[model samples]
Target chain A: MFVTPGYAQETAPAEGELQTEIVHEEGHGEAGFPPFDTSTYPSQLLWLAITFGLFYLFLQKVVLPRIGNILEVRRDRIAHDLDQAARNKEEADAAVAAYEQELADARAKAHGIAQTAQDAAKADAEAERKSVEADLERKLVEAERRIATVREAAMKDVGTIAEETAGAIVEALIDRKPDDAAVAAAVGQVR
Target chain B: MAEDPIHQFQISRLIPIEIGGLDFSFTNSSLFMVATVVTAGAFLYLTTSSRGLVPSRTQSVSEMSYEFVANMLRDATGPQGMRFFPLVFSLFMFILVANMFGMVPYFFTVTSHLIVTFALAMIVMLTLVGYGLKTHGARFFKLFVPHGVPGVLVPLVASIEVISFLSRPISLSVRLFANMLAGHITLKVFAGFVTTLSGLGAFGVIGAVLPLLLTIAITGLEFLVSFLQAYVFAVLTCMYLNDAVHPEH
Candidate 1:
């Protein structure tokens, strides 16, 4: 499989006869491709210079500039994208920070208002409790004073009744002028 | 036309002497090779020397070549492969200069010969294998056995992969050598036709005109082929180099 039929046949013709001669004689020589001739050094060098110079000029003048322009455009595009991305990222971060700050500020303001309201409620409650307690104490003192006055008035009436009974008993005893036993019984009954 | 094709391979000597074993015979082929190196060197040096923000014409060319290979390597092997830029760039320039130099009237296309291209291919293959081994150590041998294969088929798959891997140099060298050789040979054949027919006089002259036109067309095509072959060579080198750098693929 490694042996290529075409090349193998071409290499050694039957019985050592040159196969290349037949092919060469078949009008292919005039239109034949000659191998590279290395005989002339100076001419070859001169031509090499000419070719190299031509290509160098082409690259230096035409192709390179076009490619360079493309590269520059690409570089500029990449840089622009990076810059835009950075700007966007910064804007996003700023927005987030601003939101956080606003949230914190709002929280602090709400806390202040709530604290003030709570303090006011506490003070009002304390004042209401003190006034109610003071009113209860005053009512209790006034009731105690009325009870003392009523007790004194009842005591005076009782004392007057006792004196009238004693006077009646004495008149009965003097008018009768009775015996000692009778007087003693009358006095006892009156007492 | 000498019957032996080897005679054509000679380049004229600017300085001639037969020293002992040194045999530093500078021929036309050597001269062109030297000139190509110098020109390539100068071209790169001049273009890349300044490296300004706004590049000069030469600088622009140099930068473009650099970026072209850079982009290609990056695309093929990812950004990690960027470090191999120098090797890929050098290979591209050398093959390109060698190819374009061959397009001249009487210069040797070094790439047309198997030895030159084979050497390049060997280098690429060796680099690939060496890097793979270095990166993965003993496990580099695992590259021959792809993933997800059944245990039973492991041996067959490994053998096939190994065979194909071994054939890398052959394919790489042959691709370049064959293209350059065929294109040059075709050009020569057409030129021969124009010369031989032109000798046939008036009516033959009209017949010869067709070949001349064909030759002109072929010459233009040859120029295109020269560039294409160079591009193919460079691209393939990049691909192989990609495997070297990132052998998992």
Candidate 2:
């Protein structure tokens, strides 16, 4: 909606006079409006240019750089965290591998020590049994030799007793010493 | 008709004041600009104060404002345009506030004035040119001289491109100023009609009622227009910025 044209300015007046009147009237046209002067254009333009320059400087120098720094920091932090996690994982894996190897080696050593001890015990048992058998065989041979000796001695004693008895019998008939004839006669009597 | 609109313009004396070599008065326009600034500050402050996750009324409005500009930038340029979100957002908010402030009973629409819009447009143009020059240096001159053109056609194309580039400020400034000025003037005319009609009898009262309803509808539409115009201004700025950032496209 527009304001009505003020009484539709008198258009029938002389052209040159009307123009002058219109110019005069225009000076009071919009009382409430700000004055429009081309003189201020240059100054206004200067201010606008200055404002824009300041804004650009602030953006390029301060604001944008700060934002860029933040992004860069975020990127580096992520990369650092990832790298540290990888390194820690590698260290953990190496430690686990070493522990497993040590565990296997310890078990093998324990098994070897047990086997050596069992071999030593078995060898000692074999040597003790052989010594016991040898002692028994020596005692058996000594006992046989002693028995033979005793038997020989007993036979001799019997022989001696027989001789004495025969001699005594001869003496009872006629006192005689143990000579060849007496011996033969005693032998016949005994027979 | 005055040959210069400046001749038509006069600074009325409301409260006489002096500042340096200038006559500084608390005139209607000055009062309105102050009101615009205050309203803008308060509105933005209140809307953003309670920044809620689920959006308590205020936060929703704030988020919507952000999203609106974000979407516009993306649409005008590309997804990469999100980088200019804050710049575009601020631009939209400033313009929207300025336009809406003028809608109040007695306030000046700074954007309707040519000098203000021209200054804003000049900044965009300067940024575009400066950024292109900084980024591409000597090769940026190639923008005016397209590739694959015969030597004979180069001059014609170069001239055309130069003319087009030179017109950027004019087109940008005119678009915003014209829209605001025209809309306000139209609204004033319709309101004048309603007031005039209301003075008559019953039939005149009925006529006044119709115009009044139309005014109400148009006012709501104007509010939407204000937001849209701000969006348009910001999107264009972002597009220009993008061109400067990557000029080949």
Q: Evaluated with lDDT, which candidate comes out highest?
A: 1
- Residue-by-residue lDDT tens digits, candidate 2, B1-249: 321122222223355454564544444444444455455445555655544334567545655665676667777778765666655655566577778886774456767777868878876788678868987897777778877889999899999988988887888888888888767666655666687788787789888987788778878888888877887898789877777666664
Assess each model's interface with DockQ, reporting 2 decimals per model.
0.03, 0.06
Tens digit per residue, CA lDDT, model 1, B105-132: 7677766766556766776788777887
Q: How accurately is candidate 1 docked according to DockQ?
A: 0.03
Interface RMSD of each: 10.0, 8.5
Give the per-residue Cα lDDT of candidate 2 at B206: 89
* Ten-residue region with minimum lDDT total, candidate 1 chain A: A29-38
Report how far residue B211 has shifted in candidate 2, in Å.
2.8
TM-score of every prediction relative to native: 0.57, 0.55
